[model samples]
Target: MAPPGCPAVAPVGKWKVIGHLQLLCLLALAQPGGPAWPCPALCQCFGNMTVFCSEEGLRNIPEEIPPSTTQLFFVETALASVPSRAFTNIAGSSHLTTLAFLGSSLEALGEAAFAGLPALRVLEISTSQLTALPGEALHGLTNLSTLSVKFSPIETLETGLFNSTPRLETLHLQGNEMESLPSDIFHPLRSLKTLTLSQNHLAELPGEVLAPLGSLQVLKLSDNNLTCLPPGFFLPLVQLQELFLDGNALMELPPGAFSRLTSLKGLHLQHNALRGLLPSVFAAQTNLTSLYLDNNRLTELPERLFHGTPSLSVLSVANNQLQALPARLFRKSPCLTLIVLSHNRLSRLPAGVFQGLPALTKLLLSHNNLTALPRDAFANLTSLEVLDLAHNQLATLPEGIFDSNIILFNVALKSNPWACDCHLAHMADWLQHTDALLNLQTLCRSPAYLKGLSLPTVKKEQLVCLPGPGSSRCRAEGLEPSGEPGTLPQCTYQDPVGAIHLACDPDACQQLSLHLPGQHFSENWTLGSGCGTVRVHITVHIEQDKAQPGGEAVLP
Candidate 1:
């Protein structure tokens, strides 16, 4: 029996002791220099191969790692620099394939630091203080495929950095301070498929900088300081599918800038200083599926600007200074599903602006200067689901604009000065009956009685029209003496429709021509008498209820 509160010492049989001895002998043979350090004291070793060390305040690489280790992750440490041949012991077996350092204070990488990593495929150093990559620092990484160094303050990349990494496929160098690259810097990476250089200080790219990147499928250069792109800049990127160039200072694109990107599907050019684009700039990119050109200074678009993009599904030109859109702007894109044209100065749109968009689902036209909509403005949008018209200068919309043919499910109408009068009665009725979610906080701006009142709270019956024809104001003119004095025929008659009323006695019968109110006609009836008490039958002819009395018949 063992002492209290202490580990018990079990009695070992001969077979158990023999098995323990065999295990110790196997571990000794694996090290060949007696028992090596089992694992790093500050790290947690999993399965005798993966080392996970994070936030342990480690200043340098841990020593005496097992020869069978394959992966290492050192995260959020205080290491300032990586020494040369940090993994030299493991280089013999060449088992390490991934080495990552995330959110650490590493400022510099020594020369030939990764000299022994022959089997490394992934090397990620993100959110660190790495300022420069000295030449020969990655000397012996022949099998490297993915190299990601993001959010590091790297100002310059050593020339010929990728000369040894010919097989590199994906390289992510975002959030750096690189302004200009060597003209032939990327000439060696012929097999690269994806590259991201966003949030950099690149103002211009060399004309032939991308001439050798024929296999690049994705390129992200957003949030850069690029002002303009030279001609033939993208002449060799034939296989590029996604391209991001937003947040730049591009004023205009030269013609044929994108003529070679035949396989591009998504393009982002938003948040730039672009004022216009050449009419044939995108004439060659026929396989494009999505386009974003918002937040620019463009005022008009060419009629055939999108003629080549017949397969385009989503297009956004919102937050621009556009005053009008071409009537056939989207006539070629029949598969368009989403369109965002908000925040512009568009006062009106052509009746056939949306002529060919048969698959449109979401349409955003909010924050414009539109006061009225065309009767058939949205007639072709049969598949529209979300229609946003909020924050516009619209007072009333045409009743037939959103007809029963539209299958809308969401309608945003807040912040519009809606005139709650007879003109808006149709809209009110539709809002109350339709299943669409009408976000109507639109208040009335006309009709002094309904000012400052919400459209929803106001009843439809309260909307009044002009006074009826019965309450029209009539006028009698051209009254003079028509017959003998004191013996004139009396004219006393009332229009059956109450459009006009006329009454006169003897000696008061002048040439009476009464003008009917609200009708463009005059009743001219002359009373004539030769004897006393002359009773005449008056025959009236109503020409669409608007003709005047031309002649009169007198009977004695």
Candidate 2:
């Protein structure tokens, strides 16, 4: 028991002893060297080690951190700039592996700002207003492996900006305003494997700028303003596997431009101003698997353009001005699976144009000036599935154009000047019979007639027919149907079928012909006879097959 003025001390049990020990431990932790600090309302503590001051209205980094704190995250704050000596005090702590300022209002980074991070492996400061990067900003990040500064306003990067980070494996500077890179900007990154600089304004690249990246596997420079490429521009990237140059202003590629890139598997050069391709432009790249050359100004291709690339699976040359193609253009590429030649000026196709490609699956030849097609045009294309011949001048097609291709699915022949003649009789039959094939709104535009009429709806009787005996003819007296005269009696027929069908024996027909005015034989004339009389003689011969089975049948 204690005195009257003092508080009484109760008898201690196990629980009371434990409570006193915890109080002593808390008091020890509350010292200057402990984890306790003047944390803000949005901060939390984890036993003497780390502080998470996330989502706070902090304008800058806190002045002081607990001495034992090994990691700090000031995420989504109102930080505008990381001032000098910001992380100088944290050099004494060796356990900090990450320091992220993600989703903050950080606008700029001063010189030597990040020189204190020694063990930092990743620094993600994306979605910032960083217009320019200081040369020495990321100098001390020696062990950094990944750095992503995407979606920034970085217009220019000074030389030696990445001189210190040698072990960097992945660097993403995409969605920036970098128009050009210094010649030696990437000299120190010897171990880099993946580099993405796409979605920028880089018009041209110095030859030596990309010559040092020996171990690079993927290089994406798409969506830029590159007008042309220098010779041997990409000759140094030996290990590059995928190169994307799509959506650029590349008018032409110099010969042997991609000769040194032996390991390149996929090359995208789509959407450019390439007027044509030289025969040997892609001569050296034999290992290419996919090549995209769509949306160019290629008028035609040389016979041996794809002579060496046997592994090419896809070749898209759509939206060009190609009027014709050589017979053996695709003779060497047997592995070509897809070919798109739509939106061209091909009025006719030579025979055996696609004879060599056996594995082709999809063929697009729509929107051309083709007026007719040969019978065996698609003879060798056995594996074809989708054939597009829409929007052309195909007036007629020969029979069995799609005979060899049993697996044909879609045949688009719409918007063509299909002549509704006897030549299209089989097509009309197929349109009504073939249920598996697609017969789009094909109309006719030929024979100086049958225009503005649907092919499916036109009747068979309206189609043109060859001249025969039943066709209208005109002849004169003593003249045969061929306008030849004879000594024997002869009669001419005028507007033969326009009158009516008549049947008579040769002897009986001559009697009726003598009743005309110009004949010498006279007849018992009927009443109200005309003053003038003409006589005409006719002859006829019946075929042996026209006789009845038993004997000759009498004429009516």
Candidate 3:
């Protein structure tokens, strides 16, 4: 006999024992504590949920699903079509919330495939061969919050694919073959906060496509082929905090491209072909903290270009064509901490260029054409720690150039023309003593005799002093006291037209003072012979200070 609450089986001759055994098995399955019931032909069971055994061999979803099953995952399966009623029995269960169809051979999502999934909150169909999304495929998913359809061969995102997901907050459609996006594709998702469309073929963003998203916080549009941004492109996203536009072909930003993004903090515009920066490009975004403009063609920048960004901390303008910077370029950026201006054409820097940046800690000025620097160029940058001036044409530098900046830790001055001369004596002294200074091999670039010699190897003897009487004093003292054979300088006093007198002191310690006419002292007085001599017919000027007290003394 069949047990109570168990379905009954019909009788047959010689099959009665087999039928009774089957009835006992059905009775065991009907009990709450019994073993799980055996699954159908193309399915397997784990507790209440069923896993279909035909995933590899099946081309469509199974027609039947257990009543207790909630979540279904078909990962890397080969389901080419989800026919009608494929999920009919599973839709009756209201507990299903998550569904993932990753790396599938699904080329299209049929209409009403997910019609009854009202409690679904998360759905991911990434890394598939899907080329198009049909409308009404997800019509009943009202509680969906996160939907990711990335890394697919999808070329078109038809409207109403997300028509039922009204409360969605995050949508990721990145890494696709999308060349254009429909304007009203995101119209149904009013509460969306984050959208990622990176790594696409978008040439320009349509203005109205983002006009409905007022609560959006983060938008990533990087790695595209966008040449220019349209006006009011970001007008609706007032609360946006992060915007990424790197790896594009943006040559210039339109006037009001960022007029509405007042709360933006991080902006990435690097790896583009931007030739110039307009003053009003970021006029509205004042709270920016990090800005990347590297690998561009910015030849020069305006003085007040970064005036509106009060909270800016990091700025990178490296690998550009900046010939020179305005004196007041960084005057308004008091909170700036790091600045990178390396690999430019900066031949000279104006005095007090970094005077206003009181909090600046690091500065990179390498790979420039700076032949010389002013005395007090970095006088006001007291908080600077690392300064790199390597690979330049700096032949000379002023004394006490880095004296006022006591907090400096590392100073790189290598690979420069460094003209080693008396003018650089103080620099050599500072280089020897400054604990923070490095690269002492910096040598002279001019005066061919001193080339390739290290600064420390150069001494006071190797340095050539200027030509003057003081420089010839040592050589003159080395000569012999005897007169030459052809020279006639042995005479003590001689006057052809008048009487000349001579005097001598017997004591070798005696002193003598001579007076001339208008010239204070004659060149012949250096002979120290206690006599006065004159050259052939050279006229002289007599001043009262040089006149002798006694008129009887003859003067030369």
Candidate 4:
């Protein structure tokens, strides 16, 4: 999530993202006739009571921060430490609502460093060398609301650190080295809403640590070593909506573990060591919508696991060791849209397994051991769009298997050992007419004569039934299209490092437009009428729903 006043855009690389915000500031101290707001030496002051200071050499805070200043950002500076009464110069300045220190080497913070700022609300000390924050450091900010000390080396948080800030709402302490926390440390934050404690070494949390934040909504504890959750650990977060407990070492969840999170919506338990889950574990998450149980050691899921979550939308159990799934597993989650069951050990799917998911659009069954699917398995998915059945052991699809998916546009049948015989004539004829797109490399892997032929480019006459009695089978294969205009469209994908390598045909068009399938809007760029590749980092956003993890996709 972005800082208090920042727009909702993800940071790139890490702490350096904050430096990008500096580019929006007027480089000059004060625009020629912008505003009279005092521009402290070594700082750029804007008309909107904001000051940005980013320069090396001088140590300590700038001599002065205009008393009328509302937001102050310090990035890539050599200034270090905030001695006692460090902000005494701006004491009692209620208009100063935000103070952030990014990419700095400030290691020490005096006990009374922020002594008397009455109305200060947001304080972010990110990506610094600070090892600890004194208990009384935030002594007099009575109305403070957001406190972010993230991406620092802070090892521990003092017990009474928040004794003075009663109105605090958001606390982000992720990316630290803290192993444990004081039980009553959060006993005073009655209005706290979002707390992110991810990327830490915490193996366990005190039962009462989060008992005070009844108003808390989002709690992210991902990338930790939490092996288990003590009973009642989440009983206090009655209003919590989203919980991220992924990337942990949890092995099992007792029945009724989350029976009290009635208002919960998103539950992420991916990348853990869970061996199994009880059907009642999520019995009370009636409002749940997203559940990520992928990348685990599970072998099976309870048949009625989701019997209570009727509003469930996104469910991912990919990358597991399952051999089979109970056919009625999703009988209650009628709102499901995205289901990722790839990278599993399953060899078969029970008929009617996906019968009632009218809202499902994307189904990933790739990298599995399945050889065939029940003919009507997808008969009820009227709204299905993207289906990935690649890298499986299937040789042929049942006739009319995909006839019900009228709006489906993308199907992945690559890496499968297709027979390219009578049964495959349906898929070949469908590919020749329908608008559905498949991988260009989808090949036939049977009948020695046409072993490596691309399925999409095969002639319908060559898909006749195998030789019988005196009949003979032969190959009249068609060549794969040259992917030029009027042929196959270019496809682009995002690499693991988040760079889009776009290939444009300078001679074909003057502008390049990218429209990600399923996205309400598109990203367009002009290639400047030149040639060569341009690599740039990207921050993904979706017009609807939470931005899902990045992956490969074909662009038209």
Candidate 5:
């Protein structure tokens, strides 16, 4: 009376034993087009060679899975221990390739746990309780190319641990408690290309630890306790393209540290205690494009330091103690697009420093003690788009300094003691026409009359350059008040209602006055009339602003 493929059952107590068969029929009907292959009672077997057994109550690997399953996910379960025969019955007859056992209570993988997974290519065991990789945990997984065991408390990786995985290309052991690596730990990983050992307590490494990995392309050793790097440490990594050495305690690097890295493209040496670098350390990295040397104590660099690296496009030497830069330091680097030299103690920049950088786009030179600039300092930056000159000792900028660059759009002129005198006429004119936005307010520092006032709102005529009362430029401008009291440079003037006389004498301060009538308005016309009075009087005008602290006056 049972279904066609269902086995017959004997009757019990004169009643047919069809209860178990009914349960099987219900599960069969849940499958698509009726179950052709036996599916696990605790898992969902998809038709595309995949099996997922992540149920909370199911503590063991399903024995009855589709034999062709290639991808198996045992996620978010309470399976405490995966014994040696855990995957034997399910993966033995199948061609399993990718297996992920994530976020489970998996504490230990018994020896030979992966014995039957010969075709396994990727295995990930993250967010689990695995503390160690047993000797034969990956016994027969010869074809495994990627193994990631992250977010676990794995402390040490013993030697010969990965002897069975010869074809492994990627290994990630980040965020672990590894303090050291055995000398021959990675000896069998001949084909490994990427190895990340970040967030560890590695203080030093043996010279020959990485000598066997000739095919490695990327290596991350950041966030460690390394205070120094051994000589010839990177001599074997000829094919490496990216090297990260940030977040360490390295104080300096020996010469020829990167001499053999000809194909390197990106080098990160930021966030270290490096105080200096030899010019020859990076002389051989010809293909390197990006270099980060920020957040260090470097005080100086060789003049021709980056001359050999013609392919470099971006470089940052910010947040250092550099006081000066040699002239034409970046002359040979034509491909440079961005340069950051902010937060340094640089007081001056030699002329023609950026002459050969034809492709330069952005230059950040803010937060320094530069008081003046050379006339042609920015003459060669034709393609510069953004220039940050804020928070410096700059009181005046050279005229026509940014004339050559027409593509410039944004410039920072804030936090500087700009003198709003005649010297700034050309710059003010340029600022008025350019499309650059003054996101910050620029204030004047000199010419007592313009102090504390925004530079952009000051008029051109108000920028009149009046030399000090004792300066030679004042005498040249016919303002030398020499003779006594009223016997000074004589002048005569007349208006429709009255005549006026003026003199550039030492004591003329009390006798000089001019007025225009407004009903009852009057200006005391007190003059001795002793010096030569005018026959054909000429009219003169002067204006006074009482709001000025000293009641300043201007004559036209």
Candidate 6:
């Protein structure tokens, strides 16, 4: 591992983290211009501590290593074996803390190959042809803290190979062909904190394999062929905070499987065959923050699954078969920020479903079957910034649905089958009010005449009418209200069913008048969807206008 405060380099594949001091050593390998020394002819020395060699045909270990060298790396070398006492000449004086054999063809190791390097803290052998190591391969390295033997074909490990290094902490055994592990292989390293065994062929693990790693904090077991986890498999990982179980064949997680891992903060179970999750599976994980269960076969999640995990912030359950969610499912998780429920079969959202998530910033419900949203759907989401309702069956939004979202700036309402009618006047009014709204235009997909027209350019009058009666034959032609300043066209629309919807230009301020003979009725009025400047509406009943069947009830 790099020193305590080394600037971090972005990790590539399984490249070990190295400091700038070590990076200079690598740069010397390609440039061959570091300070001169009595170094091996093919090796380049950096300062007084690091030596790097990358000659392809070199057959033996360079015997002239500087005694001040504390770090050595052999890249793409032909060195085949490290005989006993191979580095004894300089080990005592060098006090090597890091050694690596990358892209090497090494196949065997002498029992005491690392004898005199007692201060070694990091050792690695990756992209090599090494097949196996004897039980005593690491015979005397007691202070080593990091070890890696990745991308090698070694199928098995001697259970006693790590007996000499009890203080080891980080172990990486990924990219191997090992189908199974010896139950006692990791029985000695009690101080291990991070273990990576991904991209291997492990189908199952021994029940007692991880019983000794009680201090492990991160366990990565992704990209394995695990079909099922043996019961009590994670009981000993009480201190584990991040666990990656994605890219496996597991179908179900037996209840209480993670009951002991109360410290878990991030759980990745995506790309699995999980059909469902039990409500109490995470009852003890109150500290959990990010949960990923996307790309699974989950048909539904238990309503109270997240009730115990109030600390959750990021949740992605997309690419599942879920059709709906409980109304108060997230009542307890008030800290959620981003929720992705896209690519599901959800047809509707329960009112107040997201009313408790006041801190939510982005919510994506794209690619679903949602037809409409309730008016107060986002009542408590005053902090919401990004909302995606694209690729659904949404015709329009309910009136004042976005009134509470004052800070919302990014919204996606495209790709929906938008019916351009009076019901959609509210959407146009919202667009007019929020002029800064991105994705300004969407295609109207209904009413053959308005089909292919963009919503932003279409006049409000062209985008109106209730479902039946004279709603479609809109006539914005009649007498203006008395004392009105402008010669505004009277926008009249009739709805026999309880309400009449209308839209007009705010500048003209249209005055609506209706003439009904021998009939009068009570009135109920609300805000109109016109320019939003004028208030209109008072129900006028019509008994039977034998001359006009479209219900022109009251006299102007």
Best by TM-score: 4
Candidate 3 lDDT by residue in tens digits, 1-556: 2222212222325734543224433543453432454454444444555233325555666554555555456655677765442454553345666666766777777677776667778788878888877777776778999888888887888887878889999998898889888888888877998999998788866778887788898899989899988777888899898899998999998887888899888899988999998887877767787889988889999888888887777789999999998998877677777799899899999988888777777899999888878898889787888898999999888878888887885778889987776677877776665543376656667444456777756653334333343322111111122233334332333244222222222221111112234323223322323233323222333345544432222221
- lDDT by residue (tens digit), candidate 6, 1-556: 2222212222328777885346656564454344556777677677656777788877787766766777788888899998886777753235788889988899998987887788889999998887786788888889999999999987878879999999999999988888889998889989999999998889999989999999999999999999898889999999999999999988999878899988988899999899989899889988787889989998888889998887787889999999998998899888787799999999988989997786788899999999988998889798898898889999878877888899886778889988877688787767665443454557888754467677777666456444344532223333233335554333333334323433333234332333333244335333332222233445443334344543432222
Better of 1 and 6 by lDDT: 6
Better of 3 and 6 by TM-score: 6
Better of 1 and 4 by TM-score: 4
Candidates sorted on TM-score, descending: 4, 6, 1, 5, 2, 3
TM-score of each: 0.77, 0.69, 0.67, 0.79, 0.76, 0.78
Q: What C-alpha lDDT, on a 0 to 100 scale, does residue 34 get in candidate 6?
A: 44
Candidate 6: stretches off by over 4 Å: 1-36, 90-93, 432-441, 470-556
Candidate 4: tens digits of C-alpha lDDT, residues 416-502: 999987689888877875443556778988744356889888655455454344322111112122334443233222223322223
Please give the range of 10 consecutive residues that has the lowest summed lDDT in model 3: 472-481
Output the TM-score of candidate 3.
0.67
Question: Which 10-residue span in candidate 1 carries the lowest summed lDDT?
Answer: 1-10
Q: What does candidate 2 score in Cα RMSD to the true structure?
A: 20.4
lDDT of 2 at 444: 75
What local distance difference test score does each model get?
A: 0.74, 0.68, 0.68, 0.75, 0.73, 0.76
Best by lDDT: 6
Q: Lowest-scoring 10 consecutive residues by lDDT in candidate 4?
A: 472-481
Worst 10 residues of 6 by lDDT: 1-10
Candidate 2 lDDT, tens digit per residue, 112-203?
67666677777777667788887878867888888887777889888898988898988888888999989999999888888889889999
Which ten contiguous residues of candidate 5 have the minimum total lDDT?
A: 471-480
2 or 6, which is superior by lDDT? Answer: 6
Q: Name the runs in model 5 displaced over 4 angstroms.
A: 1-58, 91-93, 433-438, 445-454, 457-464, 470-556
Error of 2 at 404 (Å): 0.5
The better candidate by TM-score, 3 or 4, is 4
Across residues 1-556, which tens digit of lDDT does each residue of candidate 1 receive?
2122212222336744443224433543453233333777677555556666665578878765666767777777788888887667642237778888877898988877887778899899988898888877787888899999989888888777888888999999999888888888787799999999999999988898888899999999999999999987888999999999999988988888889899988899999988988788788877787889999999989989999887777789999999988898998888777899999999999987987677788899999998888898888688888888889988888876788445885777778887776688887776775443365566777654466676766665445443354432232344555446676444434344432323345545322223335434444443332333222233333444544443221111
